[model samples]
Target: MKKVFQLILIIFSILNSAQQSEIFKLKNYRISVLNDSIQETSGLNFFSEKLYTFNDSGNPAELYEIDKKTGKILKILKVKAENKDWEALTNDGENFYIGDFGNNAGIRQDLKIFKIPFKNNQLQNDSLKIISFYYPEQQDFTPKNISTDFDLESMIYLNGKLHIFTKEWASKSTTHYTLDPDNFEKQAAQKIETFKTGFMISDAYYFEKKLFVVGYTKKTEVFLMIFNESNSGIFFKNNPWKLYLGSALSIGQIEGIAVDETGIYISGEKFYSPIGNTKPYFYFIPKEKLKF
Candidate 1:
């Protein structure tokens, strides 16, 4: 019996180590500190071959086109919708989806996503659409502050649907849900899959059958997870390649990620804590630099 128990402990140790292995550090990949106008940069996406980002809650409802090389704001486009804690940004080929569902307290009833039309290198704000949704599993309306698992921040567009990943602060996991882009009426998100990410997922980007998610732990440790799509087009069915990016103390609060044929782009909002403060920054990782 003693020998059997010892073997079980050894196996558990090995599994735990594999789950949290530190693969890469992103400190060396930072490109430049972003401008002050978008200090609270929350989400990133590409439209018409241009990189775009916007500030989060309490900021203006505008999107900024940024230079991929220098992190400078090239132009700003106004939106007709409300910012309302916008935390995730994604796009189909013709439209941009902005998720305004950052439910930190987990008591918000107005979770919504704004679908804005983009054409001819301009935003057709007159045709903006709002997608309101709720989690059917959420029974309690009590405010749990930062201890709720229903808060969401990461999202992507795939297979003609909007895929949302919850931040899951209390559970240290993320739940995947899908919403219809054309459904403007109040609807319930369809739960798909959940993964034990061990961190709060802030943003996700999908490219070439691979999904990249970025977030930070409460201890200020930031990480990146890469998962390959399964045969049935599901993520999180297999173990992801989890890489430790860096501490938030040094990297700021990483809140956005976008990928293109060239490589990956990440953005961090200005972060302030009792220990230190980090300015908003932008990072670029070339495709060749990644080993897997």
Candidate 2:
């Protein structure tokens, strides 16, 4: 019996090591309703101190810009076709890249991200770039059965490359992968690392040497994982993912996160169906308040 107990303890230790994540708590900020009509928001981004989001409720996905710290909608931009299925959003310091690749069932044969260039809030023609790619290892569109497996929900740009993180709803764990920007082919991403998040990872952002990933469980929450590395780059592998904040029980779905030298920003997507529509949210945690 003693030998058996020791073996079980060893096994549990190894499993725990593989599943550890950040130590900080997640915090969610509330939003005031701007419109009861703009519903089922799917994608979001931060540009020029403003929050930009898109909806996938019906034909012609619409774009809305709002104040960075307030949920107030400032402007509603042009629409771009129907069923774009906007999933994730990122920027390259100059233009915004909107990813329309939401393969929840894994059956999608074609996936793409649109790069829309913006100058002083005005759209530019022929400046639109679409990036297309797919998963190399996946042969079928079956839901993942494992704890740490999930589909794509969010991503960010690090060192000129697009790093995508998956949100495995069934497993509550997150996986990390990277896409090369210079490689126009937009090949299947290479696996970088995995954080046994133990929570749904909705979006990620890299700022001031720290990485912030947000999601929730019993309630809407955010996980702030900080990376400590040398100038060589790959050294980030050694950084520990710790819990950042735990917000109010009322905080809804946190779908997007973006960071700058000033502070960190997050956006909440409205839940649809019988419950009706909830207002979109733009909340921020200052740079000084974010613990490294």
Q: Which candidate ranks first by TM-score, i.e. highest?
A: 1
Off by over 4 Å in 2: 1-31, 37-39, 56-59, 79-83, 143-150, 182-186, 218-236, 239-241, 244-249, 272-280
Residue-level lDDT tens digits of model 1 in 77-162: 89998888999888898998999999999999999999999888788999999999999999997999989999999889999999
- lDDT of every model, 2 decimals: 0.88, 0.60
lDDT string for model 2 (1-292, tens) is: 7756754564454345335543333333333543443445555677766677765535355577866666566787774434446767777767676767666665666666666678888655366666677767667666543332436767776688787877776667666777766555657867766666656766766666566667654333445555554443342456455654543223346676677776766666664323234445556766676544
Q: Positional deviation of 35 in candidate 1, in angstroms? A: 0.4
- In model 1, residue pairs whose N, Cα or C atoms come closer than 3 Å (at least 3 residues apart or on different chains), thus clashing, are none
How do all models score by TM-score? 0.92, 0.74
